[model samples]
Structures are given as structure tokens and as C-alpha cells.
Target: AELEIERWKNENAPPNLPELKEHLQTKKTAFVLQEKRLKRLRLLIDSNKFAEARSEISQWKKTGEDLSGLSEMILNLEHIEKSDDIVLDLKRGLAWQKYPDSYIQNLKMAVDRCKSIQSIPRKSFNWRIPSKDELLLFFTSNIESKVQYNSGSYWSSTTDKVWSDYNWIVESKSSSLVRTLKDDYKFVICVTDASSEMIYHYLDTLKF
Candidate 1:
């Protein structure tokens, strides 16, 4: 029967081999991503980190990512948290994950280490300081009252290539864009791809 099925597949093969190959490659790429997710889920389950696994599943659902077998996995585990609740917890986190490291110094170091958490949400947060433009927008936006940060300047991803010693920051008091030494102590908030409401909720509680 398997041999007959192979014969049937061969007979149905497209004449455009290049296009067929491209299609097959796309499927393979998707399959690889799915496999990684499954592996991560399994590891989480085995390690008994059910909340994190649920969080991952919720994040995927929020982003509309394909969750091929995740629902079944959750069922198998007897996880009682409703999908809505799981999503709510994630929303509470702002989907803005605080890195395990409380404080990190220097822009280069922050960039290098922050990439490690990409596997959590199955997407990279791309931990970066807000740009001057982004910071200005944040301050001027209607959510300004809700938006809060530490008492001093926080680093912005913007850098002065000409002046290698300085980096830009958003001043907390005036919301003015200014330059400062990267070596200074400044609170950091990683970026997130959370939903609009989640993002707004996050901006309200942002802290050092």
C-alpha cells in the first residue's frame, strides 16, 4: 500500500519542479517552527512549568500564530486555566517580559543578552531602548498620565556614532531627549509586541 501511494504521488508531481521545490521548502520551514514549539512545550511540561507553557500558548493565540496541537496538549495536561485567563495573565505581564537580570549596564551588553529570551513568546522582543521619536510620542500621547518610569533618564536605543562615548535617553521629568554616558545607571524596559490594550496596560505600570 505504501509503495502504491508513492507511485500515486509521483504520478501527481507537478511539471514545474522549481515551484514544487519552493512549496516543499516552505512547508519544511513551517514544520521546523512547529517542531521547535512542540519541543518547547514538552520541555515545559516535563519540567512542570505549566504556567509558562500556558503563557506561551496564550501568546501564540494572541498573535494568531498556528497552534497546531497545542490545544490538545493543554487538554492532555489537564490544565484548568481557561484560554481567556491565560491570555489575561499574559496581558498583565504586558507581554513585556522583564529579563531575569534586574539591571544590565552598557548598550552593547543589553543587546547581546536580551536576545536569549526570544524563545519564550516564540518571537523576539528585540530588547531595545525607546528611540527619541518613540519616547516623544509616548510622552505626548493620551496615555501619558498612565505612562510612568523611574525618576531619572532611561536609555534610548538611539546612539551618537560620532560621539562614541554618549547615548540618548528620555528624561523622566521633562520628557526631553538628551545624551548621557552609556555607563550610567538607567532603568531599562524591553520592547514587546503585545496587543494594544496590553501595551497600554504595560505603559501604565512601567518601572525601573
Candidate 2:
């Protein structure tokens, strides 16, 4: 009777084993399909086909499919695309090179204020403006130097060295206002940090 009982148990276990193996196989297949879909979506995004990629994602969602890593991938791709688009727009606009007319006028006012001050000496000067390339070199070099010195937050804490080299002789001083001599120039060439509000002024002072 014990032998008969053992035989019955063996028969049931073997029959159930195939079903368990099949279930695991189905799960593996589903995972692979999801992975393939995710990879394709990524490729589309990289190719700059965001609309289609989004549409495909919507379709997947409608089908109640959960992509294992799709959400993170989509977010990353969107971020990259937005960053690239912004750079492209900035390059096209050349917004950094020329100050707006109002800003230029304000700078002129500052210069004029300096001229009105009696204590400042006005010297006739013909100074070379630094080029964009030169400014970039100076800005990068300064940041690098700060890093070398082991300064904390090289971008924020370091004084903008761009304008520091010039003889910032108070060109003029009114009752309470003073202006630097170089303020007359519409756009003084300097590497400006948009985030740090720091500029390396008078980069032209460098021998190079």
C-alpha cells in the first residue's frame, strides 16, 4: 500500500512540473518582448522621432503593458532632446554676443556718470576688445585654475577674473556712484557665466 501511494505521488508531481516550466517560459518571453519594445523606443527617440516614440508608448499603455525601464529611458531622452534644442536655438540667435540695445544704453549711462566725476582722470584710449574665442579661453582657464587650487565651488566663489585685470581706475564718481573706464564700450568682451553672474572682465589684458 505504501509503494502504491509513492507511485501516485510521483505521477502527480511529474505532470505538474511541465506546467510550471511552461509558465516560467511564458514569463521570460514576455520580459524579452518588453525589452525589445523599450529598445526600439529609445532608438526612435535618438533619431529625433519623439512624436512617434510617444505614440508607441501610448499604445503600449493602452494595451496594459508595463515596460520595465521605459519611463526612465523616455525621461532621459526627452531631457537630451530639450538640451540640444536649446543649444541649437542659442547658437542661431547669437544672444550672448550682443547686449540688447537697452542694456547697451544703460552701460553708456554708467560710463557717462563716471565721466562726470571730477576725481577720475579721463585718458584718450584705443583698447583692443577681446574676441569671443579669447574670452572662452580665459574663462575656462580661470575655472581650471580654481579647481587646481582646490577651491570650493570654483564657479560661484571665485571672483570673475574676466574684468579684474583692467585698470578699473574709477573713471568717474558722482555723489555716490562710480563707474569703470571701460564702461563706454557697447559690449566689453568677457567670458560671462550665465549661472554664476560672474564675468572675467578685461581678458584683453592678457598678453595672448
Which predicted model would earn the best TM-score? 1
Can you write out model 1's per-residue Cα lDDT over 98-182, one digit (the tens) per residue? Answer: 2234554676665555555443333322334556666565555543344344455666778877888888877757878877887
lDDT of 2 by residue, 116-164 (tens): 4322111211112223343333334323232112111111111224665
Per-candidate TM-score against the hidden true structure: 0.40, 0.32
Q: What is candidate 2's local distance difference test score?
A: 0.34
In angstroms, the error of model 2 at 63 is: 9.5
What is candidate 1's local distance difference test score? 0.51
Task: Indicate the TM-score of model 1.
Answer: 0.40
Distance (Å) between predicted and true CA of 162, model 2? 24
Instruction: List per-prediction Cα lDDT, in the order shown.
Output: 0.51, 0.34
lDDT of 1 at 99: 28
